[model samples]
Target: MKVVNENLPEEKPRHLLGIGEPEDIVEGVRLGCDTFDCVAPTRIGRTGTIYIHRNGKLEKTSLRKPEYQRDFSRLDEGCDCAVCEKYTKAYVCHLVRSGEILGGHLCSIHNLYTIVNFTNKLRDEILHS
Candidate 1:
């Protein structure tokens, strides 16, 4: 990314493809990427995994796991997405466990929100700096 940034015109916007992981996105921005696109968030969410922020880092939790069966906490404590605000890990887990499509949809919403929000914050920091 650094090499590409160095070779490209600084005035041109950099659009990174197939890059969506939070850590990767942060690094991409630091290396001069202006935008990114990928299906990771929704793809992983469909498989029952969702993103969560913990200790200032992003992590994934599988709703299909037995551990989430009774976890009443928000989908992500740091997130303000509707799923995190209105749903519990236990309920989402039940939906996943029962093969309900809503579980995937909720997870997708949360994951997409997380990435978009993170990117927006990164953009704000860069612009303000």
Candidate 2:
């Protein structure tokens, strides 16, 4: 991590790489990381992947299955992001099923939003802490 941070521009915001889990993001923020990116969400989404949150526990959906063909729901109901607001699970699932480029893009957008937004929130938390 030190080596990677050393290579970044001193004037630029410091970000931690390969962050995935929500808790990991929080830790990175505590460590002064201002940015983070991960491929898990999209990589998994392209395969009919879904994410479920229940009792504060995260459940990842696996793509390589036929069940998502008709399941319709927001990827994360708690998420008010564009993808969750304007899209449906069934549609995204279909896009993935049909090998549509939009599917991955949409998923990537959401995933990016989730990470970036979470990081921002973490920053806010740190400022107040």
Best by TM-score: 1
lDDT of 1 at 71: 95
Candidate 2, 18-114: lDDT as tens digits: 7777777666655556777777767765555655555665556553356766767786776778888998777887787788978877776776566
Each model's lDDT: 0.93, 0.69
Which candidate ranks first by lDDT, i.e. highest? 1
TM-score of 1: 0.95
RMSD of 2: 3.9
lDDT minimum window of 10 residues, candidate 1: 46-55
Candidate 1 stretches greater than 4 Å from native:
none
Would you give me the overall lDDT of model 1? 0.93
CA deviation > 4 Å runs, candidate 2 = 1-13, 37-54, 57-59
Model 2 CA lDDT for position 99: 88
